[model samples]
Target chain A: MADNETLDAKIEALTAEELARGLDIFRQKLGAAGALWLQTCVHCGLCAESCHYFLTDHEPQSIPAHKLEQVASAFRGRYTLVGRLAPALTGARPFDRDLVRAWVDAAFGRCSTCGRCSLNCTTGVNVPAVMRAARATLTEMGLIPADLQQVVTTALETGNNMAITREDWLDTVQWIEEETQGAVNDPAARIPVDKHGANILFTVNPREPKFFPLGMQASATVFYAAGEDWTVASEGWDLTNYGLFSGNNAEGGAIARNLLDSMDRLGCRTLVIGECGHGFASARWEAAEWLRERPGFRIISFLELMEDYFRQGRLKVDPSRLTDRVTLHDPCNTVRQGGISEPQRSILRRCVTDFVEMTPNRAENFCCGGGGGQLAMAQYRDRRLQAGGVKAEQIRATGARVVVAPCHNCIDQLMELNREYKLGVVIKTVAEIVADALVLPTITPPAGEDHDVTS
Target chain B: MGDAGLRLGVAICAVLAAVALLLQVVRTRSFGTRPPMAEAQGSALRGILYAFGPGMAPSAKESTRTHPVVYALGVGYHLGIFTAFGVLVWSMRDAAAGSALPPAPVRQVALVLTALGMIGGISLLVRRARGPLLRAISIPDDYLANLLTTAFIALAGLRLLAGSLERALLVGAMLLLLYIPLGKIRHCLFFFPARWNLGRHYGRRGTFPLRH
Candidate 1:
């Protein structure tokens, strides 16, 4: 990853040769499904209202269909029959420097690739997939937004996007373990680290250690209450993958491989991805696609695991503990893209006394305007905040005191939105809320044996 | 042109359209569907079924529910196109056999469908031309495609209801058929697969047949 100066110089120096290379990458990435999506769009414009950007900005350029037209037009210009003969008739344009810049703006800055528009598209066009394809081309051309590129570069070079050192991670985990012990009132309770043959190997967003160690303590407390065999790897513990956002499959695959390798080394049978939406989706749904092989171990979201614990009588919660009006902001990757909608709602229902639903929730929920790596792009901060007005209003309508966003990325954006919009809402992760509502059972230590309090 | 020339021209145009559409399909298929390497959390078949079935219902999609009139017009327009094709084939067969128009009931049904289709097509065209959002996104091909299809439907209805202007109807059919593979109208060839792909994606991830 070059400095912004070098990247800008490269963009300014782009020539027809570079344009051809970019177009070649685009053509390769536009697989059959992508081609179908591009060809199937009828310019119905119904997808416009489905987008938070379009709703907030009210700009025609913000419409998903129009934003994708950059890619679609270039694809049609080079590939389709009508476009080849009469490009203007089909609105096809040659891929050039201007188009490259447009791709970056639309694919990265304007859209979050939330798939809300995709779901509502009358033609069933996978809008996010197309945007991702556009992003992939821009990435190959070294045209990604500098801040977003920095995140992906950092994750690839370091083990995590936040670049938290191994020592710092271990120290945070140890401190959180102590907090968990006190919360559970048992010295024997442990946040196990690198314990071989653990049933579950847990992963977390690096933000948990860097900025929100209490989230880790909350998860550890939940694990203790459930008496579960779970271990967190000191290495490869970061679940959030910036590769998915940057559209760099090789880097994404490397990140996923690190986690899988850690799981194997720890001999954990199930990989539990913590409350990171894109991380959960990337690991659960896309890791295999990137790595081209499925892992022997099962991958599940922490929410799902918690749900299982409740179902099997391994964990209990008292909803009366959380009396505040709570609303769950479904992360696009986790609920819409990852298919883990019910477990979170089920958990919320069990853990919160006053749970309110967003008007269009579950698979239909609007994004918090933080996805697709928007939180990392400082250049687009105003646009990102503006787009998030839709989500802020959604939260305002619920009038919930606490907005529970399971994904760390969504949490960050929602926090910013809380300040920008002055919604006066506290943002929380699922683990924190669930930990608040946990009902720990009393266990007695046996004489002459070291008490395994969890068991 | 005479009736014989008109029939021959329409026949040739239909064959050309079919061939062009087939080539497009083959080209699209040449790209090959990437088999998802990830283990399935749910069934792709179920998702695809839902996508083509209940997923298409007005209640299932926000766009359709919000813009019921547009969705309804689009649906009626497509239904009319399909119905008109059937009528065109039947009428061609009758003409070739030197027979009168099909039974009065069949002609009446065709008339009703073609009329509905023409109305839907014209209304949609107006919406596209008038609505700021739609107008911004639409290309010239959109207008041309809509006009050609609506004209074809109108001519088909006239032929069925009045039992005249067979040549004009045939010419309209020929032009519309020729344009099918060249413009935005080509979505007809990719719509099913597009929906199927969308369904399979969500289905395999356990997102479709939404559990909510």
Candidate 2:
């Protein structure tokens, strides 16, 4: 939608339109739970132990309810009486720009906005609504984090966050195809980029090209084996939007638009967000909504895709492919926001013989402590590991040797979890499991599906 | 104040006041929970209402099955307290007869029983702190509010235990009443409307039903 601008250029070229648009994200979200968020409570303390961040950090200050209080306190002071009278006593303080900015950063920039807290909030305060309100404020405050801000700017400018040249995207796909072809016996494997009107318009974070190409290769192998016709966008691609994590709702909305518009133009039926956690979480649950419409295509995860194949009897899991004891770490967004507990469990059940269930599994599962740009913030590693302690404990209790996280952030966090707690639980994606569970000389193609859609 | 009168009055009033406050804290503690840094941001007045709770309102999302006990308890306890509070706030004459509102015996009994009920709640709060399940939740305020309020009540209770005068205890009661408008205790006045509004709003949004 715009041209590439370096960080300095972006700073120099900031327009009133962008400024106004960014700031409005906050106001639009305010009456969000309409300040009912301001009202509901009994202060039961039931949610204290529900959060991994609170538990691991053991900072009484970090408790989910206490964190929620910052907003609640503001709401009371701004809108109600007792807040006006005894603001500090009741913990309700008058809202100022600094407080608003702090809230924006804490809720949007710092918090995963993961909705995990809401799941456990006994009052049903909808912490996400609170978080959205804060995010809206951040959107207004012009406080978007630079990393995500840049990604959004790039996506809006060059049609992709990584600014991956068309040649590079094509070359990456070709490289994946070639890698999969060499590794497996599937000579007919296809890496379909820019195919129009396909069932799925699959996209991934540019990190796949930049750092983790095997993920792309592995996914291509799965798609090739499954005989699915999924296309990648020639431009306006890459599904990852760090902006959403960083609390830049406008940026989040914009990045989403770039991808959705491409999918719409190509007339794809579904948008399969390849395996990045925050990106998948952003595009599906949030960005789509912010754009004022459903996404151009139904967005499904690779885990969902695998579940479909397993359920439909299209793919066979040999079970012997994985010798490690595996447990699934349901990404908070997928499990909590997306309500994907059933499909995730189904996929895990089919592939791993030794599947261990963490106590608060499913939607109630702990965050990677790395979601919501936490991992993206390399500076926050100490806090991340400390916050991840509970999860590390849960994994250790399972005695599982490996963690099969379906999201990228979860994988990274679990890696850190393993190292910090010394749990020795190796982290992997569902694709990694499928890659192993798959035992053919190559993924055996269904009948009459040898022709590449790209052909 | 004579020792007999002072001891008796302070003991009874302190017990009454302490129990009332302890109950207040207990009741306030039930208004959902504290998530990190996210307190309910209703105006201070409304927040105080929610901390006290509106009398026995049910949120829209509140399922009859899951909340059957709560609904029953809330109606009985909060309604009793509301009725008691109404009588106390309205029935303010020195004499038992010719008062504009219901007399102190009825109000006093309501207050005392309400205090006892609150004591039960405070006891539950105590158990929450003591129990392993909730020990980690035993925060400074969680424990302090109940114990402090209980002391005020215990002083009143000690007066009741000793059968002591009424003015000093009355002043103690007044002091607490004044404090309610300012302290975390303000939830006493604000919890009801705040929670009801929160419930109703979320309910309307189809996320959670408004509590009636």
What is the Cα-based TM-score of model 1? 0.96
How do the residues B26-116 of candidate 2 rate in per-residue lDDT, one tens digit apiece?
4434333422121111243443343234312344122322445534443444443454334333323322344433444654665565566
DockQ of 2: 0.08
Across all candidates, the chain A TM-score values are 0.96, 0.85
Evaluate chain B of model 1: give its TM-score: 0.93
Candidate 1, CAPRI quality class derived from DockQ? medium
Model 1 C-alpha lDDT per residue in residues B133-202, reported as the tens digit of each score: 8888888899999999988888878878888777887888999999999988888878888899999999
Worst 10 residues of 2 chain B by lDDT: B33-42
Say which candidate scores most in TM-score. 1
The digit string of per-residue lDDT tens for model 2 on A1-455 reads: 12212322443455656544433443355542334444454455555566666666555546556566666666666544556775644566655544554464356434665665554444455566567666555545455445545656777777676688888888887887777776566666678777888888888778777667887777776776677888778777787777666555667788777777888788998878877766666776666556656553467777777788777776766886676788878777666554456666787777778887886677567787877767655445677788788788888888888887777667778877787789976777777678767765435668986634332
**Residue A332, candidate 2: C-alpha displacement in angstroms:** 0.8
